[model samples]
Target: MPNAIQDQEIAMLRSELEMLMKEREALLRVAGYAAGFIAELDSFDVPRGAMQAAELLAECVNGLTEETLQDALSAVQAHSVA
Candidate 1:
C-alpha cells in the first residue's frame, strides 16, 4: 500500500513538471519574439542614446536569469513615477 501511494505521488510530480516545462517553453518563445521586435526597432535611424538603451533592454530580456529579471522589474517599477 505504501509503495502504491509513493508511485501515485511520483506520477503526479512528473505531470506537474511537464506542465511547468511547457509553460517555460512558451515564455521563452514570447521572449524571443520580443527580442526580435526590439532588434527591428534598433535598425531604424534612432538617436544614439535611444538605440543604446534599446540594445541594453534587449540584452536584459535575452539573458534573463531569475535574479536579474527581478532586479530589472524592480528598477522599472521604481522609475514609474507618474
Candidate 2:
C-alpha cells in the first residue's frame, strides 16, 4: 500500500539524514582543528621544523574520522601540557 511505501521512504530518509549529520560533525571538528592551529601559530614564532610538523599533522588529520580527530586532539593537548 501507499502508506507502507511512505513509511519505507521515511525510514530511508532518516538513515540518510543520520549519515549527513555524522559527516557534518566530522567536517566541523576538522574546521575547529584548523582554526585552533591557525590561532595558536599566529601568536608565536614557530620554527621551520615545527611548521612542517604542523603541516604533516594536518595531512594526517584530513584522512581521519571524527573519533580519530578527538583522539589526536587529546594527544596533542597532553603533549603540549607536558
Candidate 3:
C-alpha cells in the first residue's frame, strides 16, 4: 500500500537525520580540539618571563587573590619549563 511505503520512507529519513546529527556532533568536538591545539601553538612563541608578568597583571586587575595568582604563575612556569 502507499501508506506503508510512505511510513517506510519516513522511517528511513529519520534514521538518516539521526546519523547526520551524530556526525555533526563528532565534527564539532574535533573542531574544538583543533582550535585549542592551535591556540597552544600560538602561545608557544611568547617569552616565558613576559607571559608570567602579563598573567600576574591580569590577575591583579581582575581582583584574583594572591593564592590564585601563585597558582597561575606555577602553571605558566611549568609550561615554560616543558
The candidate, 1 or 2, that scores higher on TM-score is 1
Write candidate 1's Cα lDDT for 1-82 as tens digits: 9999999999999999999987765555555555556757835677877877777768868688876455544544444442
Q: In candidate 3, what are the lDDT values of residues 1-82, reduced to their tens digit?
A: 9999999999999999999987755544443443334445445676887777555544443464555445545544554577
RMSD per model, one decimal: 10.5, 8.9, 12.7
Clashing pairs in 2: none
Q: lDDT per model, in order? A: 0.68, 0.69, 0.58
- Ordered from best to worst TM-score, the candidate numbers read 1, 2, 3
- The backbone clash count of each candidate, in order, is 0, 0, 0
Q: Give candidate 1's error at residue 40 in angstroms.
A: 0.4
Worst 10 residues of 2 by lDDT: 35-44
| Candidate 2, backbone clash total | 0
- lDDT by residue (1-82, candidate 2, tens digit) is 9999999999999999999987766665665566467557742587776887777766665767777666656655654577
